[model samples]
Target: MRILGCSDICSIFTRKKKINTASESQLARCLSTLDLTALGIGSTLGVGVYVLAGSVSRDTAGPAVIISFAIAALASMIAGLCYAEFGARVPRAGSAYVYSYVTMGEFVAFLIGWTLILEYVIGSASVVRGLSTYVDALFNNSMRNAFKSAAHIDISHLSSYPDFFAFGVTILFSAALAFGAKESSLANNIFTVANLSVVIFVVIAGAFKADPANWNTHPPCTDEDCKQGKGGFAPYGIAGIISGAATCFYGFIGFDCVATTGEEARNPQKSIPIAIVASLSVVFLAYFGVSVVLTMVLPYYEQNPDAPFPHLFDKIGWEWAKWLVSLGAICGLCSSLLGAMYPLPRVIYAMASDGLIFKWMGKVNPRFHTPLMGTLSAGLLTGVLAAIFELNQLVNMMSIGTLLAYSIVAACVLILRYEESEVSEKKNDNTALTASSVLKLIINANKTTHATKLSARLVTSLVFLYFILCVCFTSLVARFTHDINNLEMWIIVPMIFLIISLVTVLFCIYLQPVSGTRLTFSVPLVPFLPALSILINVYLMMMLDIMTWVRFGVWMIVGLLIYFFYGVRHSDISVRKISMKSIRLDGRKNVDSPKFT
Candidate 1:
């Protein structure tokens, strides 16, 4: 950080200790591999799998729905490898938010943090909305009457509630986070395991009923009036597959969440990375296998793309099958959303400690030892978004923001590596005598310093590549794809909105003051990743129509209004900046090494 003097560096160090004040004793390092793996699966493989199968089959991949799932799986695998490494290395809260802070830049950190508002918070809302609809269906189907008068409510003021039970649950999760890390992890463990069983059961039993004929031809495409067997393979064609991938990509976003727990997880160096890859692998298998069975058991067009999977078992007369699926989804969402709740506050706390956000955001509950302010804000925003936005809109917006953040994080790793290479070599010149020995030393040092950098960049790249397919596929639907009912328009708008939001956020981050930021963990390579991230991002935007762009503009305006009116003066970062200057002469501020048993 050439921008800061030695005193500034000292200030940064002092602030770091304050962000995570919990002792390793306060937080449980007890998350087993199974526990971690379960969190990964629970979060990654939620309701998206149930709904996406029908959407892809009916609109995008057709029988090639298998291939679309396969493509997403591959993309996730590539990104997973990087995430694993970072999770292992950083093992800190704030996943990409922290990754950007350490390896990328502050603006990058802020952008990721801000955009994640779309991911976890918006995502939680989306899930709640989905769960609400499903619950409503179950109640109505079972009761055969209006249960509104049943005097039962999941959340009060049903129509006014954010999404579904999510806001309600988020309030609880935020409280969970504030009180302690151990309690949250334990809660995460229970829900994750329950959901894992659900996916495994869905996959195993589902496989038994597959009919091969479903793969041979399409019954019909409701998206268009088609002759029998005419709209076969690539159901929606390459274009539709791409579009569907964009939407379906929502399922894969879960794997990335594993990184968000980098700081909290025990042995994060080992667990975080493993959790990511394991989760992706597990979800891929389940999603692809389940999608195949879904098509086989029922005609792709026959399935309601909007509400397919839960109804899958009920249609077959499997008693409580729909309920089981719903239960699994609810549990899975609870655990993942809880995990999401943990990272953002730690990040805001970290930023505050660094003078990025409000000082209070960085302040720990002395009694609870958690970031009280950060977690609360995240929960509040999540509730509001869920209450207002519909499921499809929230999910679409989330996809764009996630893709944008992942893509940039990937590029930053590469950029940092390239810049530091020359300096590294110039310093290490002729360190050893023998040619082999010298070569070995240089190579070893480069590997030592650049390992994290390389892995991060590659992961970022693969993630970006996956989203590219999603963008292109979705855009094709806009151009050559035809739809009578306007479902395609939903995908188009999100893509466009994503581009606008990404660009605006990037500009905002870039325009920030250069004083307080530092590039401590830069890996290497820059322009290439950024350029590609930008290109693919822009292409995604153009692929959609004006309507999508307009909605995205609204989101940006809202974000700006919040930042200028509230976020600016109240930012923790700014507080940290002031705190940096007000240290004790001896330079110690009640340091504590928090640990979870």
Candidate 2:
């Protein structure tokens, strides 16, 4: 009668259980291509570009802030390609969580699912926090007054409340999430479209203001200017650009979130991949142009935390622009919040299907088809976090979790490819074919060849190598370059969260390996690509101050408690299910499927 920690929960989640793989509940797939793309933009695009871009440009790398965005975008794109292919093949709900369960094991999936909470729930509230801080800045006489008033909302329940304006905003969204994805998607469509329109207009309108001289203002640094402008190209040079890129990584956190909705989307196979790639491409252009303009008009050195973006508007004597920008930011962030809200609950619902969480939370609304209970829990959790936590620190933790997840997902694609190849090579000769068919032969051939047999070992080797590098970047690089005391107190907390989540994931993996899951292709050298992703991402995280690292700890503790107390018993995941549905990739019966939680 009493299910408690690992052992108790393990009984319910055991691999031996032979339950029905047939799903009872099916959700209506109402989203169109446009809706899906809009969801991507909703989660991506906002403050990361509009707000953070300016600060990095001003304070860190000046004009080269564009490079920072480019680097982060490039690294994300590598992982995104893998995400696209896998998401298309699977189209399930748990996103990386579900993907990991099938490909690596349950434990990895749990780690990913647990980390996703940091990425979305905490990340979404950070958006609200960003919105509030910006709004508060406008209402108060000065940015100083806004910072004081904006960081805390009056709540008897939680102390260290930041910004009441966003407090109401988060509450409104919590209720909205309860309604259904369609309603939220619909609201998101209207606001995000209008908001994006403003961005385009700003880009065009600001184009007229550019001084050709402005382009010349900061050239790629000669050693001379490094001494004058405090060194490097623009301000931070290549070095600063790297730092800015890491900091701005927070800005682009939501792009991968789009992949999470594979199950709910009408045509997830085609849609999820398209939207993920297209969304990031669009944001890249938008951010690059915006940063360029801000630097030209005011100069990045002139910008500081006091009034990062609005101060630029202030200089233009377009105080009205500040209001307009704020409106745009609110609209954009709401969409970001919407994109985030849409995927996470369904993941929990999916996790429940696997028997990882409370089964009660997995209930889907019969008519609306939303995972209402999961939605409510995620909303309540997010609202509380938004009401109390600081934005930058929380966002950093979100990035770390997200990067780790992305790196894993990307590596899976390669692993599965090699896995398939190796299996085929065992069945037949892999070396007889010409070099052309050699690669293509392995790729096209099924999982039964002597070559593919070698490929599996190759795949496993690369996966380990890539993961080690990712760990190094986050743990070693982030700690050494960015720490203040050189003690790295900030690193310890998130490590605990990461360690615990990974352990839970490891447990899940033991219950079920890739013995039964799908691996239909032959991929090559996954280690290099994933290692690149890890290196780039860790460098980015390192740029953030110690405070950001501290916030990551808080999120982990909360996620771990929820997983054990709730997710453990509810998830339908186990060794038996994996054995049964390892190759099953359909989306309709997906009504009962848990893709990512």
Candidate 3:
């Protein structure tokens, strides 16, 4: 193998590959836009509505959890547009992985595929663990003890007990996937519809049961002691709403699952975008409506973590509604698990087929024509993880993976668009002049366009601006609220950042471009929207605790080791290097052409 150097690293990061949109013989294109939309709804609506609604309200945001959901939805919408553009352009499996490969390169692609495992596999495991909690509520603790005793597994001495139901659900869904895509879609559709019905019922029921007294925006809390203890609309103040938005980001995680279904989607370019947007909009409204009524139905303090909806019904003396709500949660969770697990195998299959993993992992079952081996492997691994570990840390780790991937995808969109604009300008110049004269024409423009120069500088300034502003805001808030000796030092950083930010802003204003290339189906405001998306994702990622960052770093290290030792040796790029090799970004290869290196 050839040793890589600085140029090679730059090439890997900067060079783009043609998208692989060839129809695979193994996977069927049977999913419609509605089917894709249902998937988005199914994957996202389960745990957020059933579990997180009350938990976040009780612990963090109180009645302002509605704002949290709204904030998260806005961030997801911004990221969703980027996903839509790529999905439309590529129409391939491996969502961000394929996008990065075509626009970023193989190494970045590998990292994205690795990060996606956290989003899909570990994410599914987290969902399964959540499912078990609801299952325990439905069956009572008796069922859990029965399974433990029957299996001769005694973890009574441990801090937390194992969840066998979670393990069983993972295996069950793996079997469903092995059966085929058509079957899985049918089940998903049925369960998703049921989940929707449940959400609607909760909203309607809670509306009728709502008490005006429960809608207090302020409830006699001015100090830290009352803010930390009480459960009113603004009990924890503005900070709680912001923190809740970061936490509620998990609710918006599922809409991107539609991107992973490109290989199987009919008219993927249209379907993926529609499904992502439509599903996110639907879920946001549902979550917002349910949250509004939930707080009004019961004080945030009295909400149950596992069965908040049912508890609301029971509170109103409607035993029938309580059971009905529980049943809906079960269906919702089952569909969510199905949606979560569906993408993992396909992602592994995409990577394996590219020779980044064991080749056998790419094999499709003859009868089902799906990635059976990968499905089973993903299932067993998630089952074990869900069974053995507590999911609080795992869920936190999952969110970090999500934010990291979103940031990369946003960057990819900006880079790819910029490259396209360059290509357009080159073509326009060539068309207007003869090839010999084109070289002498001198183009006369700056090497970097004004927009490009400003964007680069603005992004850099924003990063510093973000940290500094955050520090200033926190320190200023702390100075008034708590005991802090070095308030002046804390204030200084923000002041410096503010000055730098103002200078950069003025510079950008002065250097605005006269005209730029426009993208078809592109994100509005080009660099600004994509840049903001990245900044927001990074901010939320920073809000995650230190241990989550540690876990994420460890995961990245493992991915790097696998890539260096296994992927680099077996990758298709490596094999092509031994013969004639040249990658064309224009979707056609000229192997006889000279290599860039």
Question: What would the per-residue lDDT of candidate 3 be over residues 427-485, giving only the tens digit for each residue?
Answer: 33333455654332223233334333333333444434544554444444434433233
lDDT by candidate, in order shown: 0.60, 0.65, 0.75
Clashes of each: 43, 59, 0
RMSD per model, one decimal: 11.0, 10.4, 6.9
List TM-score per model, in order: 0.69, 0.75, 0.83
Candidate 2 residues 1-597, lDDT tens each?
553778845544333222222333365667777787787777888766566776777677777787888987877677777777777766677788777777676556766777786677767787777776666666673543554566645555444544455666776786786676677778988977977887886777677776645535543456655532553345555667777777766666777767777766787767877787888788778888787776666556666444455777777777777777778877887787777767778777777777666677778878678787788788777777776655554555777778778767876665554454313425433456578644533244443323345445544554565456456546655555546225477865555565564444333222212222343321223434644564565555555567666766676677678766665544454444455675464544676767796
Mark the 10 consecutive residues where model 3 has the least summed lDDT: 438-447
Best by lDDT: 3
Cα lDDT over the full model 2: 0.65
Give the candidates in order of TM-score, highest first.
Answer: 3, 2, 1
User: Residue-wise lDDT of candidate 1 within 1-597, one digit each (tens)?
Assistant: 246778864443323222242435222355666667766776777767667787777766677777777766765565565556556545666666666666554545655666765566667666655555666565664421333344343553344332435456567777877778667767877887787788778878777777777666656336476633345555566766666665565667766767766545666766776677788888888788778778887767677787676667767778678778778877766766765555567666655654454566677676766777777887777666665555554455666666666665554443333333322324434344577754444235344342232333333444345446446644654464465135677666765666565444333222221121233222222333344444444444455446555755677676656554565445555555557767642254334445559
lDDT of 2 at 587: 40
